[model samples]
Target chain A: MSPNVKHRERNRRAARWLLGLSLVAALFFGVRVGLDMVYWNDPKHHEQQLEPWMTIGYVARSWMLDPRKLRDALALEPVPDRKTSLGHLARQQNIDFETYALRVMDVIARQKAATE
Target chain B: MTEVALEWLPVYGLPVLVLIIGLGCLGAPAPASLTLLICGSLIAAGDFSGAQVYVTSLVAAIFFDHAGYAVGRWGGARLAHWRIPLMDRARHMLKTRGGMAVFLTRWLLAPLGPGVNYMAGVVAMPLRRFTPFDIAGEVVWVTLYLGLGYVFGSYVSQISEVLGDITGFLAFAVLAWLLWRFIRSDLKR
Candidate 1:
């Protein structure tokens, strides 16, 4: 109700958000010891392995979302393990080279749709 | 210029490397001027050639400064999420001190360029307001270092001795700050 309460509340949210972010960054960038501590197995190293459902999450995390869209997208049920992780899918079919190729094509199609 | 030490360490050696690694060493425990001064000492002590060390250190300094700048831009508003209290302190410092924060970060504290860049971005400071000061800081900062090194080239040892003392103190200060934060945060939790 008071300004002090509001300021404290805001700072508390900021601190909590920052703490979560640090843990995520630490996990991605590796441990405090050194860069060497970031194992090859770390998920960040496998960024290209992202799946379709995960894009919403990544885009959301990147703060590129249009507010409610991200939350709503993520809130929906995940579409099962369509193809393991993007890792196995890429290995099996080179999705980056293939699917990404098609996604570019899809953009063109969408562009055509927009013009019409 | 020291040839004897360069033989063992190859690009002048480990102290320089560690210095760079310390916060990527781009600027370091002090200002860019102090870095050049310390490198000059290695030259005077016959540790490495002053010119060669200067060139390498300069390249590293420029590269990292710009790199920090670019990365700072990439994170922009997200800098607040960094959780580095120094950055938060810097943000508050900039808010109060205004342009003076840029000068101090570039010189006094030496965390100005990248650290302040991100803080500025987070606060959404105008790029115009940011660039000229940054360029001025870099140009002036660079000139001061190289000038100091060249002027006192012969007395590099004295320069290094003084810088080494200051760096040691700053290093301890940094470690103490980190330890303090760790303890304080733990207490907060």
Candidate 2:
């Protein structure tokens, strides 16, 4: 075979391998996207995980609690600002963040029990 | 670092966003998208105003993109002088397709955005051309993620995961198509 023919053959083989790899990758990610969308849309997965990043309002919305009710339940004296996160609040109050988070969680649980 | 950035977001607000988004634009491994999503949720929760988040993030992204470009231009100045065929082809590709590359990578193929910025600079793409596309793409990126977070609220993490997968899928699908095209053209030749 001429050099040009050999070069074309090599390019053809490389393209086939690359295309095969790309197909596999595309399929994998496509399947993952579908699975994630299904998982995300399920009501069972709707429960929000409470974290240090959550503000009072975020927690209130996530748990379907009235923001005013949560504020009153937490007895945030002077009312923590709208943007104040539970972790930041804990820091200001000289409490460990986990302890403060647990306290907030407890408050939520009790409030849910009362409403139910 | 991602967790620390997320945890500090509510405490520090826009400044945290500004810092992370800027760093992400400059090719840092920051969770800039997640920050934007959480900020959108915060906006929904009334912790932040939409205008502030939009304006701050857009500016930070554009500013840092230019900063990345400047770094690339400065650092790659010597490399640009090399007469490699690959470099020449890359320069040609950037001249022809750099706008679309800049725009798509900004939002749709976002993981490549920083690298594209650097490459555009290395190829000495015109600033005037780069700026408009960069701004347009960043606007779409900022708006899309923030909008999803705002609308989805508590599901932001899951939404992020799904969006990430979709981006991966699109990238690989495009690669597959390009490879197929190359094969067809090679056969013709």
Compared with the true structure, what per-residue lDDT tens digits does model 1 show for residues B81-184?
A: 75554455546655666465555455444533555555665665555666566555555554566566555544333454444444334433443454345445
For candidate 2, the chain B TM-score comes to 0.90
Off by over 4 Å in 2: A1-31, A41-43, A80-82, A89-103, A113-116, B172-189
| Candidate 1 residue lDDT tens string, A5-104 | 6755666565555555544443432332234334333766532222221222222323233323433332333444221222233344555534753553
TM-score, candidate 1, is: 0.38
Clash totals, every prediction: 4, 0
Question: Residue B19, candidate 1: how far off, in angstroms?
Answer: 11
- lDDT tens per residue, model 2, B53-152: 8999999999999999998899989877755433564587689988988899888877668888898989899998899999999999999999989988
Q: Each model: TM-score of chain B?
A: 0.50, 0.90
Alpha carbon lDDT of residue A31, candidate 2?
Answer: 97
Tell the DockQ for candidate 2.
0.52
The model with the greatest DockQ is: 2
Candidate 1: give its CA RMSD in angstroms.
23.2
- Report the error of model 2 at residue B170, Å: 2.3
Q: Which ten residues in a row have the lowest lDDT in candidate 1 chain B?
A: B1-10
Which residue pairs come into collision in candidate 1? B2-B46, B2-B48, B20-B24, B20-B25
Q: Candidate 1 falls in which docking quality class?
A: incorrect
